[model samples]
Target: MAERPKNDHPIRSPDIALPFCFFCMMNEPDPVLRTLKITEYFKEMPTRDDRESVLALSGLWSIAMTRPNNPEFPEIGIFECMAKLICRGISDREWLLRDQNVYIPYYAAHIIGSYVMNRAEFAEIAVESGVIPPLMELLKGKISWVEQRVAVRALGHLASHEKTFESVAEIGGGVVELAMEISSIFVENVYRQFFCLKQRLKYQRNLLTRGLGGVEIENRKAEEWAIQTQCWSLHLLNCFARKERHLNLLCKRDFLKNLCQIWGGLMIPEAPGGIGLLKTLCKTEPGRKMVADLEQVLKSLCVLARSSDERQVMAIECLLSLIKDPETRHRVLEISVLSLVDLVELENGSELKKPKLGNTLTQALLQDYHKIKYGNQKLHSERAKRALEEIWELKVEKKRREKLMSEKEMKKRKLLVGILKKQGNHKFRNGEIEKAAMKYTEALNICIPKMRKQRLVLYSNRAQCFLLLRNPESAISDTTRALCLSKQGSPHSRSLWRRSQAYDMMGLAKESLMDCLLFACCRIKLKHNIPCYAARMISKQANATSVFGCVKVRTFEETKSLLENRQWGNMTIGGC
Candidate 1:
């Protein structure tokens, strides 16, 4: 440079003390050496100074974000230094360090989490560095949700490793209880204290917005972080629950009730949230019995059972697991049947689709009902037969009426369908999706069976509403109905496309792949992304069918071969 920078001048100001030599700084550009030099400076400081610690931490935080796996930082006492800083931040009463201390614990815990994320060896080193106590302080709400988030995340990573798990677990029942408590309360706390505040700290704003974007982005990131905080705490609890250590604490009736309420929204796809942990608890007999005993919990699971969420299978599995246990089956059968009956007629397929688990559970329930209410005696069997015949006739009668309208009546009904369909379109455009679905239902209800074209449009339109409403099962049913109504030579492409999306939402990769491929082939000008979508579904299906405990993956050659063999001679449809 033509002129030396202010800070690089030979005469340093009283407030601006440089730790490393100028010649050394000019010669040493290596990140590892620079990190070690900073560590040495931190360790050698005669007295604690907020500014120096903050600068050192800022540098380390950047390094941790970029190259977390580097062992040199932790090897040269950085982990130990961070741990001590966290404790000092908690204990420091000086007004001078108070502001800086608020950020120290969050960064420290985050640094510890980052280093130990991928390697258990780093985690073991972190444990030896005495990071547990400081992290525990953050976990217990020594600061705020900002610190608590990183604290729980760091603890979860530590708990995941075999060597460090005991250290975290040894923190005892308090950790589990704290996690459970925090899981239920973190969402409200973050929302009220952070999002609701008129003026927030610069660090809080930076953390929320990641130093970019505006209010909407800040709100969205806040939601994602809030969910993450709750999910991480639940994940921490899941670790203990999986090992079957704190069953009594985890399975407490109030906590289980609170657990039932955690939805783990679509923001974090991989974290199934509280229901995931509840599903894990159900793997044991004690868990099944305790969960089943709560009719309220069973009812909540039933609601989730019919939802279009990714975790819908976990809810169904929990119910089926409960029903399989002889002690709890009767307690659950009545509530389970009410939700599962509508699903039985639908082909739920597999894990990717809604599970056909309902069929087996439903059949078992009916037999149990017949046995319990009507007995196994021959006389009771005859009564059961009569009851079954009456029920069958009721279903037959409803379908029989739809097909038996006169031409004059059909003409009047077709006009009514046209009007209702218009209203549905109007409602949907206005963003009133539920109202739109109802209008479509009204159109379908009165439209005669011969009006296949009108019914097809009505069904397809309603299915879109269901998809928007996140009711994939209903969407699948309506789409299937529309497909069935279309002429054999020309399947309705819109219905096929909607059903494919519904199937994808339910995690039925193979069915989704098949439907997506079929949709791509319809005689319509496809969207530019159609090919990519089909390819994605193929990749997902291939990954879905991977063999357990094997690193090797198989291609979707089988799905491709199956699609290749299918006949597609006459399907002509308009573009979606």
Candidate 2:
């Protein structure tokens, strides 16, 4: 056709090797075929280069598996292959590191971790294929920090599954012991750095006082790594301690002491997760009894309750769990009432509202003072009564403020409705029927149900616009509502007359006749001082004449038979 493209030329340079086709091979559309090809590629690997390629492919597969509707890696032999790779990586550790290929084992464990994340069955497979032991070894700082974090995270994932939790717990030398060791090391490092920083600051301040400026604190990277390690360890322990036996074992360790140290604002960021662990521990009787003895634990929790952070909710929950036991309740009450008042003060209009905290605290105080005994029982009772009264008064005041605000809002809406109605009337007078209807609709929206008279008038006014716009069905609907809202002799006869006209336009002859009959009766009762029975009789005669004049001959004949038996008045044709 035209000159052939360069890529189509048969003679190409041979020196430029073809671009690596790794993704093309992995993206084979059929899952089974793709898995088979990948497996064969793994088997053909006989060199370090081939192993590196396989490791890269493993990372890709791990990412692909996370997407919805992606083909799954073959479960039959994949875990075993990954496990073998991990084992090989452990043996080849020094060479891999020397070659800067630490990512080999990291990606291997990452692939295994991704597999076990949401599926319990695969977790069991990972455990059975001897993946846990290497992961545990990796946590001992034998590898890069990145690799260690990955291994810990993998263990955390595996430990979360019910089927593999016990196995992970066992292979890791017990979750409680492992987590305690890691947390202890982490806490120690944190405090050491903190105290060192404090002393350095003091020295710097002394220098400044002696005519030298202070030096800035150097940020340590290890501290960040320590936090991550501790967080992952806590996550693993939390998963394991869901069972009663593991929880009891955790309580036996000095877990509460370490947690209280963190809880006492040593590191404020860790309190949320620490309190969460406390909540879990208190689920059991022995755990509760142990936590009850830690006075620092109770005081720290009370302090946390007043914080405006999201952690406040968790703190309150943990406090309630502790106070369920009699001894713990007494211990909580021993904390000064002044400190507990924040826990009892209700937060109004707070995004993080916790109404239950105030109620629970009041109940605890009352129970401690009135239901249980102390040395100053009467004084405690009187204090408790006074606190209860204060709480009640606060609640009442909040309700009063809310009620006043609501009334103010209603008055504002009513004022807006009045303005919108006037705008609508001006539009209607100018023959802007659609604009008038829109304004009327806006007015109706702001009109409260208590403003029945205003709503009735708006509906009737909009019905007239609907009639001019040739929407007789809507007109009839609005007028019917207006009539229902009006009393018998009210000035709503115009609404009835308009509805009759709308019915006639819609070819509803029988409905039109009935509305006309009611309208005539209402008009006669209001205009003429006649007895109710006489007014109704004259109105029926007028209804017959009006129907005959408006409807077709066929409809009039059908209606005439229904009204022919009633007595007729000696009225002229124009009198009706």
Candidate 3:
């Protein structure tokens, strides 16, 4: 196998400051010896002497994160030490280590994940150090979702390497099965237990607050982490699915049905969620057959394909993949035709800009559909022509009518549009929001597209009404249109604010946060709490993107009792 590519820039762990300062106090100046001393101190330290072990683990975690490519740390048995601490934390319930022991498994697993992330050789050494079994124990929920987060991360790194993948696969189909379950149903419980609950653990408070904020910040951080846990599990599942291992386990009908619903939210745009795994499955025969058999899955993809969500491209790709295979093409063709047709003209559509892939894929799909449905006939099928006409007729007729209008009649239409706007504003003040929205729609219909400034006002006004009606999706679309018609960089601030609010109502924190920031930037001076609110969301996002940010806060007592009472019995790895 070729060598794993390196990360040119490694992520510096945010928790490194205090640990690095502590390491600076050491008399030994050699970095390798310093690392070895730390590892040996952690490995040989007796249980219950908690402070030094915590310090040691922190130092090692920093080293692993900041300098993972250095082989000296792994050669000194750091991975083995991490495995030992993890196992002891799981099986041994020492009273002295109780308060601090809850943190050990998380740090140990994080250290292993960080070190093995970019280097296959390091991953191989990690597998050799017996990290997988202990990591599997954590993956099986020996403690809590926090430990499971890092454990899955570590296993994902191990599974990515050609040499180390077999070691992880050797753990059995249970790993894939558990990953599928986490990807599907574990986020709600994780969110409720750590984030929504009023009682906060000390570690949880430390991670969320970090001496800077309050309950709101903590809640946002918890929500981001909850979503991230699912994202990381999907990453692990993708590793196996990418190579077609455990297809029998990964391609479950219920899992695929649920996977279509997991979009990973707009918060972490990098994570494709369930559609990502489905795309991988569609690459193989059994996987494609399974996905093609689920009409509900196809319907979900059709809905997502028509959405403005970032994952729309992934949805389209899955549909295109389904259509590529002759065997599966017929099964998906009828369901996919209308959705694909909506995209074919987007490249040349009235919108200022759109995804180029949509036009290319849809045109290809339409041609293929025509050939399949009409068999080499040059004549368009009635259904195909009707679909195309439905898409283009109104826009074409509008242009043609405007071109034929006399100057006298055009001036009358503009006058009527202005009168309609005033009436809409009057209705809005009189508490007739629906009537106000209807007035704006009528004004917009009469308002020509060339009258962009007029159309902008109409769209923005309608967006406010949609917001009041609790239809955020429509509000987002209207504000988007208004923003497009406004100035390029500094669009209308009201439209930005409305769109931000709409995104927030849709549970899209990052999108809302971005629009909020942009809205502030558009104005010279801010008069509202948007800046403060944006700052809070920024803090939450910072925590969300941190290397080990998703680790749940398990109290020492809870961790100890849970680990002690946990029993393997005859269970296989990841069977829990």
Candidate 4:
């Protein structure tokens, strides 16, 4: 509130001045404009001191452009510029800058990788720009790990697109050889680390014996780089192996043995990438032959099949592919693979355990084993045929037992329903109509529709309870169900009569008359004295008038009067 000390300057509010100052401080160049300017500077091929700055700027641009929501890079021609940079060979002047020549291609590869990481369109563009040949050359050359890594990653991104994938296979010759070379380097590095560690432990033991503290054995930096290189090389090989020709080339170089050695020796922790490459190679006939030629490949695969890891699934798949070839199948049989298959088939105490193991085995090896074993009639036809017949008989017996058990269970349920129905009848006679209805409902709940006689009786009994409870609608519903259930003899006639009574109570005169006529016709067809017997039953019931009123013939006099008046002319009693 006090006057500000502003001498010659105009008095300014602190709030306004603070915001203005903040705005001035926060002013920065737009990232897109800066990226364009940097890209232009890089294209000028600046001096040696400016080269590192250009690479740093381009690296930042590459990272920023990799974001999904960022604007399209090709709009500014940056993608084309980067592609041209990658495709251009290293100039003699550039090669003179010690290791600076490597950085140029590395940064270009990095920018290309960022562009095509998740974008298939950009990948196709990269392939069409002819960047893959340089990248493959980088992989083939003796280069720094940083340059090789970047090149391999770029090729991998480009290979994800189908168009680019075909180009990689066609243009990128020696890619398999490169991968195998890297794999050998990785294996050698791993063995060196192992021997080094063994020696270090022994030295540490001697030092401890001499009362000096043991030394910490640090892992070599080269081993870490080798592992990363191994993974990327394997990924690239797997990509190329999608084509059969590349796969065949890979197989010719003892590739299966190398992969088996790594996987079986536990050289790398979970080499699923290598295993995946092996699986791709094994898909071809020549590849399978190469795998079969390896000394311990099949044995290692059999051991791997017993593991529970996802890698084991890939191993099993490779084994299955190998067993499809007749030569390889005979080789597998000679190796006594049946012993390994037998482990899965052994009858464990738990029924579920055996089948689950058997399913994995059958899906992978045993199914193919049986196919190969039985298809050759000249080798062991009689023995194979006998085994097949025994298996078939066992399957049939298993099915028969299942069917008999089902029938037994069904009979037991029906027996339970019968007992419930007897209890319901006892309750009904005791005049507990609601309790009797409840019991009948319980019986109906468990009663199967296939038991027509039982279901019909349950419906009829429940309908009687509904009538006693004065629920004529529900009574009609139950009786209708009973009639539909069994349409023969006494049951049908009884259901019809019960429904007629329900209709009469509901004051449905026409429907009641129709049902009564149908019931009388049914009784007449049975050669029973229909009208006399019906009248006797009606007389025994006090509420018979409501049931017979629709016919207008409750008494003999009424019947005679109807006959004389010809009121029955339109109704046919026997033709229901």
Candidate 5:
């Protein structure tokens, strides 16, 4: 099991438990104990062993120095103390010292001040000693006001260092996710910290690195300084990311996910690196490994392609560059052909997401199709249309396969229902839920009396379709039939849980509660199982009335509270 990051320390040794080290309990009035009286404990370090003891002493002293305004130990950077530990013939506990929060003050100092004193060596040492990850964590952390100011200041200086660039480049593609998530937090506030961190970063380093990009700057200039500083910050960010994954890790196909998330402000407009760098990263081996799915990457790339702005043009240029490769270009042509047909059938302006590059890509391919089908090869290509089958395969058909496979003994005679199930599934995953329901109903209509298991699955599938279409009565009736036909150990138990969810969704709480209890008691014996737990937790009811007009029981916040405390099974009379 992974160790939690909680600040609990190991048991202490008896020797170090004396007056000096155990300063909180000391009464001998020694000088070391006198200084340590401030901090409550030395974080319980084990120093009985000779080697670990020296490290423990170092860690204790380091922890004591955490507070900057303590007015005892002067502000010395961690690199200085690092040299002290190495030179003191002290045991190897550099990691222990780095792990302590006391060095946070020193870490913040290094980020801001290292460049000021031409301290490239110090920066290199930290980078080599595996300190960059934690430092980057500090940069993106929910730090105190002073800590934030210090961290940004330090990162600004370090950004200009050649060593900084090399280390960041080598931070590996594996760290892409953590980097993206943490860096994304600063997209808004970074504008505020940019200037302070930038000029305060390394001027000499920037001087050497800032090559001819047809952009010139007078560092000492006062007007619109924020703009200049932001450019530099974006540059440093892009420079770091240019090597890692792309402009931001957000654009990586495997890196990001299509989970439930708020749509707005997801784009980092301040960093124009997304379409440009990543369009290249996708073709590279490192970039390829970083992405789990190439097709998914292409779809994500489509989001950027939808941009009408100048960078979108650049992004198109990048895409066009990729198309020059026969395989990649062939893939784009195929995917876009089907995607175009999918879009035109829908209402105009259905897409609000700007990064919907797929739309423009469709247009581009349709025009190309006109050029080829009429002017060149006359290719009314079914293969291109077949690419939609993959999208349908991955996203849409998941439900159908899941539903059909739920049975232990499904009848071979009812195989046509599986086909319609796939059609219904594709329709639903493609955001055509009503059509999907129609498909499911047609499938259910075809299920023979001989195929009871198939009928149960079709009814259950249709109930889901009803819920998705917001038709509560039809959904409830279908689910009722499904529950009755489904055997105790049949695959229909899943249908039981889904019925409860559908009932919960329809605000028919009496029906919801009945199925919820049935699932909780019969199907899932455990409280924390996903379906039962979520049915009871996520579904809401009126403050004072259930669907049957009885007293409303648990609220959303109460459920959330139980979830936070891991006390979900604590449901009881009057305490819900």
Candidate 6:
């Protein structure tokens, strides 16, 4: 056969998706359109080359769409399946994953990590399938180190999951080793942004109530979780430690010292972090008594130059995340502060109204500062200056509202959002339709812009809110909008399922069942959920009207029996 002419635009650019993007999945309530688009992607993309990338990116769009504000989980399941098929095909093809051709697997890993970060259903699938182990197999051989880095990254993601943590541990997983080998290539500072935000938000509430500022008990539950998560992470460091043995050369000692100190700080809280020798002394106190006894160990930071100390960076970060908690930080400062210059000094200055007692780190700072000034040990002079600048900046901001908003206002926002959500949920719980609508609308008035998802959900709740509020037209419009942007807006059984409910609300029975079959089959495929579909249609098919409207399907005994046999929750399905 003659060679086919190659179009100049061989690989499709990322912009191809901009034209037909269905982020309308957020507000899309149409079951047929959603499913058809997905089918079109799989069926109509001209080349095998572009199809997978397009499919993978489409999956990325759904990540935010499926969050709690919108519970269209089934759409996520659908796109994840699509993403997997594309990635699986790439993994199966060896030539496709090589050097000049590495973008394939690189993008694959990017997709895997994106989904992994989102904690998509695919995460559970990735763990159960030992796919992480097999993907780690790519770490060897002559493929691009960048591709290898991606494989290691996926492992890092798996390593983060609590369920997969021990399972990976049982095998001395290769992910750590691979990551250690290539730590130089990856930057992880922003990866923990969301986790950090949630922690700060929790503490911000505490500051409001006590009229006390600063993260109290920062070492407790919040920091504890970060610490406990580290055993697996620290062990992954063995991967880096085993290679390029001189981590000390490139990476800073304070950096590595901070790493060990985080875990060590957790073990012995009477120490300061960011600079705590006493905490290190006590935690490593088997035969060592004085701080000098562990100088060799403290020197581990200098040795991290080879494997590129990311594990160390992450470990220390896990600890720093908790320093906002007072009890944990207090204990940490007492035992481990290397000098009198604790982070508090950098944060609050020496002359705050009432100064804190923990300052051993101040002393250590003096000593280390002297040693580096005198050239006793190797140092990243520029990094040290930057660290000092940070300290000076902290001193200025210590007593200031770190998060800016006043305690009362922050509390009001948090309180109002949480309470409003609960009230609306409660109204629905009690089957008080009118009350729920009022509650959600009231909440809507108080909501702010950054809380866009909540706004989206508030609008959704309002649709249901309106239904109970007895405003069907507004209800239909709100729900229709919510479904469009929701994850289920994609072609999947779930969008169909939600649409079924919406059409039923609008009194459009036939239109409701049109995709009802698709949704029903989807549920049945999952085994036990089969009854939901049948229940939706139970005894309702007898109507002769082809028109779409909420036609009450007669079900006196049919529903009564459904109530009796399915271990009924005493919940009545009214006007079926």
Order of quality (TM-score): 3, 1, 2, 4, 6, 5
- Estimated TM-score per prediction? 0.62, 0.52, 0.65, 0.49, 0.31, 0.33
Candidate 4 structure quality by residue, lDDT tens digits, 1-576 = 232322111111233222222122224367666555545544543233322333343443445456732445534444555555544433333342322233455566667777777677777766766677667766664333345666776776677567677777776456667767766554343333222332322211221222233333223333344456666667667777666656556876456666753422122322344677778778777777888777477766754443323365567667767766667765654442432333232222123444443344444443444455467433343543443343333234433654556777779879999999999999999999999999999997766546768978898899999999999867766675576455423437776677767776876543455566667778778888677645544443323332112122224444334334542223221121
Ranking by lDDT: 3, 1, 2, 4, 5, 6
| Top candidate when judged by TM-score against the true structure | 3
- Model 4: weakest 10-residue lDDT segment is 4-13
Whole-model Cα lDDT per candidate? 0.68, 0.57, 0.70, 0.55, 0.42, 0.40
lDDT of 6 by residue, 100-181 (tens): 2223444445446545544645566656544564445544412333344445545555555656555545555344444333
For model 5, residues 371-393, the per-residue Cα lDDT tens digits are: 45444633345766454443343
- Misplaced by over 4 Å in model 2 are 1-24, 29-31, 42-51, 54-58, 61-71, 74-76, 187-226, 252-254, 260-272, 336-338, 347-355, 372-576
Say which prediction, candidate 1 or candidate 5, comes out ahead on lDDT: 1
Q: Candidate 4 local accuracy as lDDT?
A: 0.55
For candidate 5, what is the TM-score? 0.31
Candidate 5 wrongly placed segments (more than 4 Å):
1-162, 169-177, 181-241, 244-252, 256-270, 273-277, 283-304, 307-311, 337-576
Per-residue CA lDDT of model 3 for 1-576, tens digit only, reads 222122111122343333433355344688767776766655574354434456556666777889989887787787888898888888875531344445577788999999999899999888888999999989888766778888888888898788998899998899998888777767655654455444555454544444357777777676666667787788888888877899998888998898875655423332467777887888899998999999899988875664444566678778888888878876676566655654543332223565555455644465453454455633234564455444343345566888898899889999999999999999999999999999999998887646778988998999999999999978876786676566544477888778877877876654565676677666655555556765665565445434223445566556444434545212222111
Where is model 4 more than 4 Å wrong at Cα? 1-39, 45-107, 186-222, 263-271, 324-327, 339-357, 363-576
Pick the lDDT winner.
3
lDDT of 6 at 163: 63
Off by over 4 Å in 3: 1-26, 30-39, 46-50, 95-97, 265-271, 347-355, 369-385, 388-576
Model 3: lDDT to the true structure: 0.70
Candidate 1 clashing pairs, residues 3+ apart or interchain: 352-507, 352-508, 353-508
**3 or 6: which has the higher TM-score?**
3
